[model samples]
Target: MSLFNKALASIGIGSAQVDTKLEKDKVTPGGEIRGVVHIKGGNTEQKVDEIYLGLNTTYLKESNDRKINVPVVIDRFRLNEPFTIGPGETKEIPFSFVLPLDVPISIGRTKIWVSTALDIKNAVDPSDKDYLHVIPNRLMDAVLNGVEDLGFRLREADCEQAPYRLRKRLPFIQEFEFVPVMGSFRGRLDELELVFFQVSENETEIYMQVDRRARGLGGFLSEALEMDESNIRFTVTSSDIPGLRQKLETIINKYS
Candidate 1:
């Protein structure tokens, strides 16, 4: 059964229906979101105190308990109060809100739901939840472009379930995995993982881990293998986006 029907059945208001509409299907970070909520009274007269619109994001929590159902509030709106409508009364309320600039997105594609609800005190009703995919902003896109330009292909992406500290307050952290082009990395590295930590308004720290390939030598050949690898920490911090890409390429060349 539909959420509308379930809510109606739960509240004994088999006559009311709710619908929500959005101006755009996709919203950019730090952009405007505009939408309208529609509510119709069912077979009988009903008293509605107010209607509300909420922008929410939900994710799963992984811990000792390992349970799901995590919802965070992004924005909210309230409609008129103490409205009385006879049988079959239809009402539409318009709402607009600003998306926060620092709202975090999952590493890859992620679906987010926005809810618009009509609250008739003591009435059975369900809030409408609409799904949208959150895409990365230009700053992040630039970084990805730089990485690809350096001949690194995306391998995988994921988010950390535990709270990780970054310079920013965003509760989630995203990791991008990549494999360097042939002859780019030396020693026996199989893959490289790049994790971005936004430390401040203008600074980002790119943390990297190299997974080394197994060695056949007897005396820790991998540890003994010494190639002049350009330190990425120094390179990325001193360079612009393009400069960072160049530095990364240089590091890969030197390591290879």
Candidate 2:
């Protein structure tokens, strides 16, 4: 029966199971994430060659003219070196990491998660997954509030594969789409799209694409050809928080 039990364990019939418990799932960009990895040995002793964790998310990529969701790892690290656990044994390993500054905010279908897996030789490895609710940090929150205060409502947000020129540390960019609701630009603009770039704790760069509302035949032609839009790039810092709305108004009104 020992040989049969070993065979079963080798095929993961009874192997180590991994579970990760986070200190808090609600996180901010560029924040600290604390957690513990609990490993429970099953019916037989197992040798774990490696243990790793990854901060992961998905972005939309276009392939053959069709959009497909692709999983990406923002950051990953190994928990410890090789180890072993006996049958019915439990091990608790604590971990901590700072979330990347460019991690996508969990809006729409943009989900960020942590994946933990154990590498077992000649066996099916066990793994665990936990989702994270990534919220805007202080500076980002201010930018969102300022935009809303300017009378634009958020339409949608998505993490899409970025163009080569606009690619930052990651291959994806998180875009915020907004439609004018009750602002001065409500009549002058069709929609305003904002993409944050080079985000950090203190400041961030923003790329704004202002699509102007078509007026006449010339405007219609230009719009149809994607020529009626204005692109503006700027940087916002913590010191700009107090006058952010006015600054944004000044910049947006110029092109509106």
Candidate 3:
């Protein structure tokens, strides 16, 4: 390699480029993602130390008494040993990964994506970004449907900072807020909030919070702003799919 070519590669004028192609961008939690990483050589041979992929998203974090969005990597995967690509060379690498159950659902302002990059010494690294549309899995769909069947309307969904106790691998949790539209709890309750955590492929834990209607209008409004409270969870399995509604109703009724 000539000194001139090395200098050009260092400035990215003749450095390798990477592009990622996903077989499918829309996926559900606990689903599989398949894709291909294409690397094209520039004017000179470049050494790629490593290639990596990160499953990334953002969550609200309290900083200086204000909420700030911060990036979080839910999972990551790294490829094999160092390799060199000769001038005008082309290479294709196939990759795949299973989505983590704890990955925040792509709802509201939550955005999920896969970041791909190649680490090259003394040169600008090439990268690619592909967004993912994460949908609810079978177990999650069952719970969501169960709530709607009970005359509750989903008001909002968000990924926010998690309490120490409820947190596991991730520092945040996805919350679903609901209001009684035409149910027995309409006047008796103010709102209902839920959180889900999947411990395995066949089982999941649901956290619940029920807010009661206060005495006066002012009280109700004030209580709406304060949704924080001690939470309770129910451990349910794939076998419970048939009776999920009844079980959820039983749990919510106890609080109502």
Index of the highest-TM-score prediction:
2
RMSD for all candidates, in order, please: 6.0, 1.0, 2.6
Q: How well is each residue in 4-108 modelled by candidate 2, as lDDT tens digits?
A: 767888888988899999999999888999999999998888889989999999999999999999999999979998999998999999999998888889999
Against the reference, the lDDT scores of all candidates come to: 0.61, 0.92, 0.88
- Measured against the true structure, the TM-scores of the candidates, in listed sequence, are 0.67, 0.97, 0.92
Off by over 4 Å in 3: 216-230
Candidate 3, residues 21-109, lDDT tens digits: the string is: 99999998889999999999988989999999999999998999999999999999996689999988999999999998898888899
Give the Cα error of residue 114 in candidate 1, in Å: 0.9
**How many steric clashes does model 2 contain?**
0
Residue runs of model 2 more than 4 Å from their true location after superposition: none
Give RMSD (Å) of candidate 3 vs. truth. 2.6
Worst 10-residue lDDT window, candidate 3: 222-231
